[model samples]
Target: MSNSSNVTKQFSAFYLENRLYGIEVGRVQEVVRSMLMTPIPLAPDYVCGLINLRGQVATAIGLRQLFGFHSEIPQDLINIVCKVDGMLISFQVDEIGDVIEVSESEFEPTPQTISEDIRKFMQGVYKVSNSLMSAIDVDNIIKFLNNKLK
Candidate 1:
């Protein structure tokens, strides 16, 4: 019998505050270079601004802020466009990493040692070589954003 734990999943990885993070490749629409953004007035601090993506406006979310990182956003950024709840959203990242394939056997639950701010949105983590790549929970992210807006 084939072991499910041997199955591998692909993730589109990125960096924020020097930590590695990944989102399921299936939900990722595209990764793009930084583009001009129009700041939204009175929007939550995490909602950095809006981007013009091929004439479609996408909300640009500063992952650092969303994750409660108290650091200034870098001038150079990468946009990881993802399809969440049928809406196109752009996540502003500090740097972009390659697509990673990790086996299910490497997965582990988020540790209690992690801070609540960052841990809340983590689906889990995958042991990668010498490091752990935290998995971002896209659904929780959208739900949190929705709640913030309401």
Candidate 2:
């Protein structure tokens, strides 16, 4: 094992829209329950769509739809705040899992050329023990939704 891998064995993987997505333990800023969303009629369906976060309006993007999968929403829905394009945005998640530290070498590069929408949503793949967490770039997600709506 390399020096970095010697210090850790797991990392936190978050459950969003039914997919297991993980980030470095240091990336997450905060976790909040699913905020009440305001319907933006003109917005695309993938938008899921918008919510008023405190005094600022934050758009909630449906990761499931973006990935071309059925949504997991019905009961458990949560908003996970992370830096997307340097701006804090709320992501609709099913539940937030515990933090896990893992080997840095476990990360695998995403295929540059994904042939489908589902594959496009995945930024990269990071393995956690026996589980696979798809690391998504929230920034690209926002851009994709925005462009689709427009």
Candidate 3:
């Protein structure tokens, strides 16, 4: 067996509906406070809209809507702008958590019990103290959105 799975990585954590999730810290550009988003006509429900980040337009995604969560997204949510496939995409999360350093040995494949909708976007889960942190695959998310938009 290869030891590559034992590499350690840093993750930028966030919360949604009290559940913890994270993305690779290297992919995260910045986290910004909630701002007005201009809605796109005929856009998918998960597409929250677009935001002007500095001078660049970033597409904001409502993670709650994308994850099939029924709870309404709070207005005071934070935007985690991530670079995926060389494009800036913003994920609106309930709240920003901390930067967690996790070992690859602690990573586990997404559980079969997890909802299929969410499982698809997950890279895996890391066992954290008292909770599990789902690793979000930003690339997969972008691909999912692309397919949905087609």
Winning candidate number (lDDT): 3
Badly placed stretches (over 4 Å) of model 1 are none
Clashing pairs in 1: none
- Computed on alpha carbons, the lDDT of every model, listed in order, comes to 0.92, 0.65, 0.94
For TM-score, candidate 2 versus 3, the one ahead is 3
Report how far residue 32 has shifted in candidate 3, in Å.
0.4
Two-way lDDT contest, 1 vs 2, winner: 1
What TM-score does prediction 3 earn? 0.95
Please give, for residues 93-144, the per-residue lDDT of candidate 3 as tens digits. 9999999999898999999999999999999999999899999999899999
Error of 3 at 137 (Å): 0.7
Worst lDDT run of 10 residues, candidate 3, spans 1-10
137 Cα displacement, candidate 2 (Å):
1.7
Cα deviation at 7, candidate 1, in Å, is 1.3
TM-score for all models, in order of appearance: 0.96, 0.75, 0.95
Q: Sort the predicted structures by lDDT, highest score first.
A: 3, 1, 2
lDDT against true structure, model 3:
0.94
